[model samples]
Target: MEELLQQLAGKLGIATRFSDGGLVRKDYEVDDAVVRYIAERLGYKAGNRGEVEKSLADFEKRRWQQTLENIYVVEQGKLQFDAVVPAEQAQSFFALQIENKDTGIRSEVAFEVHPTDETYTIGKTIYVKLLVAITNELPVGYYNLTFTVADKTYKSTLAVAPCRCYENPALADGKIWGYALQLYSLRSERNWGVGDFTDLGNFIRMCARCGADIIGLNPLNVLVHSFPENASPYSSISRLFLNPIYIDVEAVPEFKPEDLSEIADKIAELRQSELIDYAEVYPLKISVLEKLYGRFMADRGSDRRNEFRAFVEAQGDDLHKLALFQTLYDIKSTYIWGGWTAWEDEFQNPNSPAVRKFAEEYADRIRFFKYLQFEADRQFKQASAVVAECGLKVGLYRDLAVGVGKDSAELWSDNDLFIRDVGAGAPPDAFFPAGQKWCLGAFNPYVLKERCYEPFIKILRANMNAAGALRIDHVMGLMRLYIIPDNGDAGTYVMYNFKDMLNIVAIESCRNKCQIVGESIGNVPEGFLETLAEKNIYALSVLWAERKDAGWGDFNAPGEYPEKAFMSVGTHDMAPLRMWWFGYDIELMHSLGLMDEAAKNDTYHKREIDRWKLLSALDANGCWPEDNLRKDNYIYGQGYPEGIEEAVHRFAAKTASKVFLAQLEDILHVEKMQNLPGTDKEHPNWRRKLPVTLEKLEGDIAYIRNIQAIRRER
Candidate 1:
């Protein structure tokens, strides 16, 4: 396996070794057959050894050709033009011109060392400086550079970057607090079935009244809701647009009681269920949206019509493409397409003549989707405005899911930017021994560079446009991603130019004046956090995940947490505080077949010890009465105990971390987690609702106490 893997590794440009400590190299273990399978999967044809070797050589040549494209992207400033002058042609000269791709603004830049300069050396690369442009004249954005070196002309990219990323003044104070919530799980009477912007706005007021400064939400990325069962927000279709599911139809200005009378009862029935009925809610919401659209088009006054027109114009090609994609998706899924990849060729080609005709024929439907995104943005903006009006410092901190599924609108629209056949995920780690395959397509590094990273920039801008902050989920993807060949379960790492990516984040964050937080959890590579910290991006410190400084490696103390971190008792992926404390999650995992009997028993034993350690720490800190930690009370009892959740939250709040987030599950003391990482139909992920509605939270004793406890600790 080793010799075969090594042989195939070089042929495929994949590393067969990795380093964890020192500079020592280690051999990897990918079966030779596996690489052969991947090579064929990527459309390489070879029946014999010689043919396979030839194909591998051809692949390497293609990679080299792409690398030598001569496109260089530099931060905005004095443009530098570099060229080589032969010793015989030392007196040759060149001219440099930079033009803004979007704005059509052009400038002439001088080279640092011209060919006629006394110091210019023949056969040496000489750097020519272009005169620096005024910052006001040249805004922070992408530009095109055209260089003329004798008979040769070359084109490249020049991007202007802001000094540093934005960090909200309030969050920088080292003691602001927030509520972390899975937005869908929030129950409210005003929304259709799942939580909506209306609920978020109302909750913002409640949070402010309770002295909270920020409200963290789960990823709002658009999910493939046509198939309601797999509704993991992380596994979304498009991050560039908002999810239509979050639209509050009743809150629309054009919504009239008569318009939705036919479906009012269905909406009511949806709210009555404990678990969110996504299947029912999707169709009902669409019906309401259609009615609203009809009402909108009935009286398209110049003022309103122009507003929608301006939005469509500003959103540009991306929005129009997304609309067409959604329109075709709805049509084909409802009528023609059956299994995956069964869609016709024209459907696969987003810009085909047949597709263009279908789009023209279904223009109204396309506009409907476009309006859905506009409305979603409008309501979200209104919610953020409310937060600002209520005197909150940092509000609506949104999470950006790491990547999108392989078969998604974004990938379909911009297929070249994403790699197909292979899925992106994690390598082997403590929590996931076999590694994880997220079944998501990764951004093709080569295409991103060739395209000047417009796709990623668009995604970042869309996410940061309305929120006070952005939390990048699985933040490590910016650095390197694990790609599983042929969508299989295990994979190897693919490196990216993360430094430049981080710089872009800084530029966007500064432009928006929003702080950034990276979810740097579980098995992060060394120097990853340092890289994030250097960019002034905050870190997350899940209390349970932080290991003790000494002894048996129990949970760490709040004081030990970093000042640049957001301290939390638990995250959405893990069990709620009470569930973890009571061992309910472990038992649930066993029941769900996630663990065997032996593993369950061993886990429970470890859980008991960790519980004891937690109690001792809490007792030592005077968070709870020491009498609660008596040996007699520490037996095989793993039931929910009074005040433990609050104490756990208090421990988190007391951390030196600047931002402390109290999750909704801990506030409600819910046993079930919002998501089970690797499950689909086996659990009700993202479908669980709060035990009580938003209205009830204002008066519930336990809820109120939890709020006060967090505030007091903060």
Candidate 2:
């Protein structure tokens, strides 16, 4: 039974044992309950020994019967693959036709198969291996391959990809410096309340004028529109679309703020609030969006109307799914049903007749949602244009979140693409001792292969659109995910086809002309970083995580950093330099009840040591002020050190990395973290607004001097 369980789990991509985040290999004992649940999910028999054995035999038979996989990823110059065929057809000629999906060009080649000794038998029929080589050279792109062997037709997707992801030619000239910040955190006097695409454009103009090459942004993926307070960009409703809330309502054609003047006082109050009230902001923006949408529908000009139509047509089914999902959520909100999972079975199924009727009834309302996306896309393109206009090498480096929310529109649209019951998260690590259950869904590896990775390809294309670069959050997910089943206590690992996924990423990167950055921060598997570097996918190196011990200890000096990396002072999850140097994060965690008295005491002690070590490292790198090593500064830990923030920025800028990004919060010495990983509502995670407005930030003497110092250091 144990052996059978192992075989079944292996076939299902479930790791029998895995290396944890701590770099310790732990054997996962086969749990009967876990195995049973997984088997049932994968449509395998786990009732008894006899049934399990039979299921295994059937799976093996099916595997051997298939002549070709659903897809194959090959290098641009290597188009050779192995195929299985009936023994009698081994010596027959095979006709292969490859059609480029983009160009609609087809190439034909006839090749005689070279049979190998490897053979498999099912009943009376025998299958033999054939080495099929194509002489026709194909460029880097996706192609539809049709193979005919003795009148038998076999179809598969052939992805010819570059050996490595796209690397910006500017990098070869010299390393570049940039700023990373959450777009929503921007405080702009002109914005309605929350930061919008217009704010992004203003920021680009400011940073580009400062000689910046890139601007890193938090994920702009769409979230729950009605329940906007669930505002973790990392846990979005759909990665395929942009957040409409970030749309500049005033920028929308035909918008008239005076027409809605009654809410002027409310908008003023929201704009002045320190933390964003997404609940208030979402409704306000939606109200204005609805008005603009209505006006456009009533009196849009031919050119503009045709543009919207073209966008809708270009977006096609994905746009339809997103709009339909939003429309259904709007209607379901009347009853306040728990989620799509709790909806009536008829409504839950996207293709059900009942859903079709609901969609037809709310077709106009659905169009309203599509209009929002269109405006958001248009504004994003406008903002991205500023990168070139300002002479920035890489403008608007967008982020792609690791996974979608559990009950998101993405899950509602396609059930087979994801494993609904199991949740994706991280294993226990130094950052979070209890581990984390992200409450996010994991994609089914089997389903991805079956679909020729169409879902993944679409997601990359969507996020890569209108961007100079894309950062893949928790990029280890391309190799494996920590999947915790609903019925299991501790989750296990599920491996993916890493090479194939990387190849596809490379192909998309070249196609979009966008560089790739992989955030492989925690619990990364062995050789993962090296593989990413080899593929030219820049590694994300957080200053806090670059210590010699990989913990709170001595830091790796500036010159020791990787050349092919995007280094930063810290990430959104970590405290800014000011907060870290003062042990404010520990105090905040304790105050929020995330840490006990004992843990807080220990953490504070460690933080003091970390601070001292950080100063020492900076001093050694010649980035720290001469007075920072004074006895008074180290002994009292009183009155925030003035030059430390600049010193930290200097330290990061001097790293060997090809790209260095200073967090806006760190540069401005903001004490609050953009996100506190463990807490949700308990802490103001993603709601904190920047202290200064865009106009003030650009003109502030201190900010300008800091940028100048960084420029000189780099």
Question: In lDDT terms, which candidate is top?
Answer: 2
Clash pairs for candidate 1: 76-160, 109-130, 110-129, 110-130, 110-131, 111-128, 111-129, 112-128, 112-129
TM agreement with the true structure for every prediction: 0.88, 0.97
Question: Tens-digit lDDT track for model 2 on 309-423?
Answer: 9999999888999999988888887786688888888988899999999988999999999999989999988988878888889887899999998889889999888875888
After the best TM-score superposition of candidate 2, give how far the Cα of residue 215 lies from its true spot, in angstroms: 0.4
TM-score of 1: 0.88
Q: Give the residue spans of candidate 2 off by over 4 A.
A: 23-30, 110-112, 430-434
On a 0 to 1 TM-score scale, where does candidate 2 land against the true structure? Answer: 0.97
Task: Estimate the overall C-alpha local distance difference test score of candidate 1.
Answer: 0.75
